[model samples]
Target chain A: METLIFDLDAKPLREVNQFLHGDASGLNGKAFVIENPNGAHSIAVGLKSDIHVTVKGHAGYYAAGMNQIAKVTIEGSAGSGVAENMMSGMVHVKGFASNAAGATANGGLLVIDGDAGLRTAIALKGADVVVGGSVGSFSAFMAQAGNFVILGDAGEGLGDSIYEAKIFVRGKVKSLGADCEEKTMNPEDRKILADLLAKSGHAGVNPDSFKQYGSARTLYHFHVDNAGAY
Target chain B: MSEQQPKIPQTKPRFSATFDESTMSEIRRAAATGIYDIRGAGAKRKVPHFDDLLFLGASVSRYPLEGYREKCATDVVLGARFAKKPIHLKTPVTIAGMSFGSLSANAKEALGRGASAAGTSTTTGDGGMTQEERGHSSILVYQYLPSRYGMNPDDLRKADAIEVVIGQGAKPGGGGMLLGQKITKRVAKMRCLPEGIDQRSSCRHPDWTGPDDLEIKIAEIREITDWEKPIYVKIGATRPYFDVALAVKAGADVVVLDGMQGGTAATQEVFIEHVGIPILAAIRPAVQALQDLGMHRKVQLIVSGGIRNGADVAKALALGADAVAIGTAALIALGDNDPHLEEEYQKLGTTAGAYDDWHEGRDPAGITTQDPELMKRLDPVKAGHRLANYLAVMTMEAQVIARACGKSHLHNLEPEDLVALTLEASAMAKVPLAGTNWIPGVTGF
Candidate 1:
């Protein structure tokens, strides 16, 4: 597996598609660089194989949206919807990511080096998005089954209208979202997050620094008096 | 109850009209045909809304901030450039996007003038940006609708910010529909469609289907503009938490949430009232989504629909909205349903308070009316100035409340500063009871 270099000056989209349009599936052993990323968004979207795509600088919206099975990483910040609707893959952001990172994702590991914007991992079916920093409010709203772990403070209304997804936060939450609630930290949570952190390269993080939140299943179905106002 | 055996009345009128002869005649005509009661919002009945949510005023516990003597910050920034410049508004209360085809050019320009005068922004609606509106408004936000009518590079580059109109509060899942009756020659040209064609704007973006595509679409937009403009995703307030998250994921610089009470030029009445959440209910979740991302204020959040006056603005801010946008209120300021048009409204078969027929284009007031005569009734200069005054008052009011709440800036208003008048208000506001600290935690407000 030879390393492929895509300089910022080079428009790799055509070439990258050349390989993808063909059958070059796994680019893991190769180091791909989108040099001087400078907010060039969507480096590799909808790539359905385990390839490694490293965006050197900032990438714009949906940096790696709906990624199927590729391991896509960005060196700098990512704009909104990084790894959106991603179906099974690994996405890493060395810097901050805009709102809704890993939204509606299923079966993937999304790691953000820094903070994430609002509604990160919303309605996540099975994706796991680990943030190195804080998250905005309503993170993981209506998330059915996934893990959203935040290392920094959580914004107001965290986890409102969530489903069965698990949320672990190391920081303070301004408020909880409608129908979302704090749950008792069980041993399963501790083990799962610890293993996840180690696998995602945050091996030494203190698991105790996090708290878990999820839906109480009260607002999912509307009641006349308790009709879901949202 | 039927013991009296009410005899079947002979074929006559549906009922005797209690209204005057003219009103009866109009009703008879409407009955003889069809298509009556053509307005927006809760046609079934009225409810106390943001309009009814009044402030407690200066009292023993609070002091009134000077209306004009004090330094009240009203500036608001929205949308990071996708390829261009971010939008900068004079006040937090912006005029929401209302289409050009749906409204007369003078009316659109009036909104821009009014918004500019008050030092705020006015947004373009489903119909792409109009040069007249843009030239008039200091801060003009161009909207990209599902229809994509008149969309091209020049307008995209010219806009301060671009709003991706995924949905609206009035009819979230529906698209822009201009009945053939409303389609004019100029509208046809601007839209690049034949004149007098009933345009059923695609309910969804013709090119992009899901969020994944939207992400690319947003990037393409950025590329087209050379990364100088900010992108905003405007969603009708339905499943706000998820939508907010999706919007954030979509890389929106701002997430604009429009509530159920939002105004629509043309949409099914049922959809307007039956679908979507209220602006009050939508704010907390949206703010929370930002907070969850650790980008609450960093990725600005603007809320609209049912926002009226200073108190509603303050409440939205306190509830976690970075800024507020108004459509109907701005229209009212431009004389949408002025009582002065009462007789004319009667002729239109609607009352001032009962008006909802924005789609008819027969508005006696120039606000929503497209009739040349009706549009002429509203002097753009005068109406524009009036809108400015009203916007100023709203900004002042928000600032005063924020100051009283001990925050120097309007955006600093928070849930801690408010108490709800009713449990419904309290719950919707996500605030505690007026006299109690307890929120039904288990039930969850």
Candidate 2:
């Protein structure tokens, strides 16, 4: 297959993403490498396809926003709000992504290679996010239904205000939300994490070291006893 | 820097609308009808108007202090409940956050100098803290927005206060937009963007969301700053009850509410005129929420948006605001609303009273205008003095109103001392209407 490489040196995000995923006018079914993707916003936003993309540099907020079907990988530092409300396919980050990555995502797999800033996977409804590194404080906040896996140390106040979402962490967790608690890392979590890692091409991860973090199922609907925390 | 009002140029006559031949015909035709000229959809309904409220004078029961003589202090201590040491502000009137990238460095310097002279604090906007601002300001508040542009460790340590901005009043859920024109080379480098490119701010913070995460975030910031500076959480005036309660619980020392009229560096016109509740409607609910949580007055409340003068400050306090923040008015003091720049204003397709093209960066007075020539029109030192004078005047005005209400401090102005001239203001501000007690429409609310 013929591959198209984009120079990310000052190329407008809209212009670049337009050529990547905007129908036949874009690089349809062709592999593309984007280098020096510094501070570009919404790169490959709203993509729905079967093409492969690799970002070589840092990304700004809302990278791969509302992405679907296509595979997107970021290689450098990412600002807050990456891959927000994504529906399908896979979005991978090789470097640290800032807060609120995969926020309110419905479906799709978001894989981070490095540490994520605060508010990881906040309000996630139904997306599968796998972080290769640790997440900052408040991961999986108000999450409804999703699988969030953190490979590294989770920061303070993790899973705060969580809702029905399952989280897996390899390192120490600082805190848990009202409805969240440490859970049994059953075969399901292990299998899922392993599978996501394999799909995102990081087979080096050992799933057994990771523990399961999830909702405590106590403060889901706001009871009187749980009112103190809120 | 002394508390004395300077003589303003009164060159223009006390005349009303003076539209030229073509615009006058349209105005006349519109006025020919019995009804007022129709505007956007939101205008027709009985939303609260600011003109509806009036302050009651000092009565026999309450002793009014000397407006010009007595030292009714405008100084305040914020972050007392949470921080080990609270910040002692010189004046209750604070400068609202405006970014260096959005405003010129000279303008930012002026704000800092003016606020310092006036004994108030100036704030940084979405952009990171600049040395010029820090040098000029006696007390500086650094803003932490979702974008995290130019954010680093050094500036964070230097800041007197850290304001974690969740949203603004102008467009509550809306993000920051710096038009292409404003993104100069200096701005681009600071924000890590290409020069002259239109930039959009992120709506969500990079790290965490919700109070639980916010608590951790706050702790991190505190640790980074060695818990020296006070932390403030700024939210748009939406769901104040929940937001304030959450912010307080999340360890915010101060809660800032920005109302609908809050200024934006640049936003869609549709978003600005619409979105977010008014400051008037937001204060009471927030106060009630705080009181319910037993955190009332414990967590300081600073209100912003549509605040024009000292009267507005007095009213905001009476309605439960602990302090008032001004963005547009501060710019006005720095030569924003100068009628003297009327001729230059015409070329920009906006008159002195009607100009909202802050995003265009073509300000004639050098405050909002980003043009090199226009910016040269301003002298930072003189502008700073003007701003300082304005702050003192506002502070005095608040003191005068406080004394009339039999209160010593600005925060002592209570809800009972105020009466509303209109029904909407009565409902929004939680005050009784004058003449008769009935608040016109909100019988059920």
- Number of the top-ranking candidate, with TM-score as the measure: 2
The lDDT of model 1 is 0.75
* Per-prediction TM-score: 0.62, 0.63
Give me the runs in candidate 1 sitting further than 4 Å from their true place: A1-230, B1-38, B41-70, B80-84, B442-445
Each model's lDDT:
0.75, 0.77
Candidate 2 global lDDT: 0.77
lDDT winner among the candidates? 2
Looking at candidate 1 chain B, the ten consecutive residues that score lowest on lDDT are B36-45
Model 2, which residues run further than 4 Å from truth?
Answer: A1-230, B1-50, B438-445
Q: First chain of model 1: TM-score?
A: 0.92
lDDT tens per residue, model 2, A128-208: 998878898877876766789887888888887565678888789987766688888888768887887687666887888
